[model samples]
Target: MNTKKQTGIHTGLPKLLLIALSLLTFTVIMTACANTKSAFPDSEGKIKITATIGMITDVVKQVGGDHVSVVGLMKAGVDPHLYKASQGDISKLDHADIIFYNGLHLEGKMVEILEQMAKKKPVAAVSANIDHSLLRAGDEKMGTEYDPHIWFDVRNWMKATEAIRDVLIEHDPDHAEDYKNNAEAYLKQLEQLHQEITEKIASIPESSRVLVTAHDAFGYFGDAYGIKVMGLQGISTASEAGTKDVTSLRDFLVESKVKAVFIESSVPRKAIDAVIQGAKEKGHELKIGGELFSDAMGEDGTTEGTYIGMVRHNVDTIVHALK
Candidate 1:
């Protein structure tokens, strides 16, 4: 008997565990639904929206406005690529009227739980609103179909705002006008933000407009703003940077005379430091420009916590460091 094939391929222990947990949550969710009355806050007249990441959480807040209550599964500095849903999360999902996520497997492990919840509730991927042709295809490093960091591009992120507005309207037709007005206000702000970024990026000498980070989350940002982007790791931070990747990128920085590379608020600085040290050893001095919000945003209530403010901070940091 070909038990090898029958046993199924083992991707990794982490993946197996994620799958097992996903199944266990299924039963837990069912039991919780049978016993629990209200899984989320104040039983009220608002749409219960649960979002997977801070960026999407911001969209829900902006579009849903006064008519929706939102619960974000992932917090600031939380890496969604490695995030797993807990039992409490399952209860929240079970009670949510609608759920939003970045999709394209950005919430890599929580995907099954989100999809399972979709059988009963509305689960939408705001990233799906972006034009498919505009997406950056993932390479062997990411092992995915397309890159999931659409929030890096302000224009692409606007699509997320629109998607959220539409979803909210569909679910609550009573507030359709409110959702449209709020989204329109946000979109105008985003339009201005995109223009601001384009002009800011253009200010740097064309040769000097390079953005290096811990991972390849800035592909859309670079393509949209016309700057060069490189990362020590791949599209997913789950993949670690190798010795060869460090040395080659170090050589490129040295040869290109790139000024600075930025670390991420969510990612560790070790790999970026290694690349910097490698460049120094090879006769180049590269400074840590500043921390950029890549996968996550800044703390709540801070300017950088909001999407527009986050983009502004990133562009300002980049322009200051590179220029």
Candidate 2:
């Protein structure tokens, strides 16, 4: 997770023994070698690339550095689930040197367009989906598919970063080294983030490792950590939380005596509150834990506004609430 300091965009670094020291030295020396900008326009001075959303856009900026000018189609606070491409989006994609989307059918309605664009351009799904074995199937209530919210877990996102870097290197051979170095640097940071998150989550009591949400988006997070996840909605926001599912969840909350249920930043708390309400009906009272950054990051200009910041915020909130 490449943590953003403030303004949701400020972006990280580190090493082994001698190899690590040399890499750090090299990074300090090469700090001024590239720019994280767009990668189009043919003119060495200007390049234009488009990203599907803010998350992918930030990632491109982190890895592409100043070598490319990037455009993000989805505005902050916009739901990617039902986003429709405007004329401007097509134009941006048409002229982009490369494009990145959070695949695994995340952009469900937009997949056809993206595939067509991929035929004539370099495009990637950029999810841990490529590694099918690691993915768990979404429950029948959430539709018959695997959950696409792999980025919810920082460790899973590192795989997507590698995929992004590999594709960028292939398309823009000139900046292969730069892309590789940036991705490597970011990957190390993500590793550290994973450890940090693990330690934080570990600080919570083992009996408190229960994460309930509006949807099943936290499957990967729960999988990575030792938490039992219960969701009122399906894996996708498109699916509504059904009566049976809610009843089952209510039963689980009462049986497990779960302490907290979390609400996603992008989702309404009404649904989660219902779960808590049901628990109270059964003589079990559950806390709201805290608001978490789930499908999307926090409000723009905040620490949790960036991808890394969002994850760190989640880790901190979860640890604090559960512990």
Candidate 3:
């Protein structure tokens, strides 16, 4: 009887040990999974981010600091309105951990592609947080539901910075403090930029504050800075200005006694040139003020390539030419 009892006890001990080992293995796996779920990219492991335009890319870089590696799809002088994603761009988007775009139909041709990619990964519009009341309406010709050029207004861009900061925090809680600090710094810079622009624009006498350009990209800018903006084409560069449009703008320039009109870096100079010719034909000589960073920033690695630099250059040009 004693021997039988000993054998039973020994067999039961092995079964209990087996059960304990299985439970231990299960707990280890679940803990590893939880860690993986919570982990975010850090300096050791950088996040891969893709931005649609240079403006968005610049902001992301400033906010993300060193924890992120960003790839900007559209380069300087590239028109986002008509830009379509190439195969390489599509591949980049697919591999990115996150994506940022201007939205509001700004990237008109890439809208569908972005929508599809959003299903598999986190895709954000930098302008998502901007108040709708602050936005301008788009004309029917542009096929835009709203004017997509929100970055022209410094205030609007500030809202976008907040949005980007919030997204980075949500994704990388480990670096939340870092992102917050960086965002605060960038916001302060933007505030300073706004003040500088205001003073410069104020230097221009109110009557001569008329800004004419290739397209309706500067409506928000004019509204923010108290300048009256006129563009030959509609909101989107996809829309072309006809002879009638040029003639009408020319008449307005002559009647308003505007000293200078401007050409855009991304837009063809032909429309503006035509307007100039039309004004000359009517005996009103209007010079092209200077090339403005519209739809895109200046060349990469230049001061105008940055968001703050682009805004400053634009204000300086406008004030110098129109003042």
Ranking by lDDT: 3, 1, 2
Instruction: Write the residue-wise lDDT of candidate 1 on 262-321 in tens digits.
Output: 999999999999999988898899999999998898899999988888889999999999
Q: Report lDDT per candidate.
A: 0.88, 0.76, 0.90
TM-score of 2: 0.81
User: Which is the better candidate, 1 or 2, if ranked by TM-score?
Assistant: 1
> Model 3's lDDT to the true fold?
0.90
lDDT of 2 by residue, 1-323 (tens): 43545534432232235678888889965642332313233436534668876777777777877677777787656667667898767767876767789877767778888989989978876783357888878556534477778886776788888888887787778989999999989889889888888888888888988888887778988888777787787777787776787789889889887888898866777778888888898999899889887767766677776788888888888888888
C-alpha lDDT of residue 16 in model 3: 99
* Steric overlap count per candidate: 0, 14, 0
Model 2 steric clash total:
14
Task: Give me the candidate number with maximum TM-score.
Answer: 1
The best candidate in terms of lDDT: 3
Write down the TM-score of every candidate. 0.87, 0.81, 0.86
TM-score of 1: 0.87
Over 4 Å off in model 2, which ranges? 1-46, 128-130, 139-144
Candidate 1 regions with alpha-carbon error over 4 angstroms = 1-39
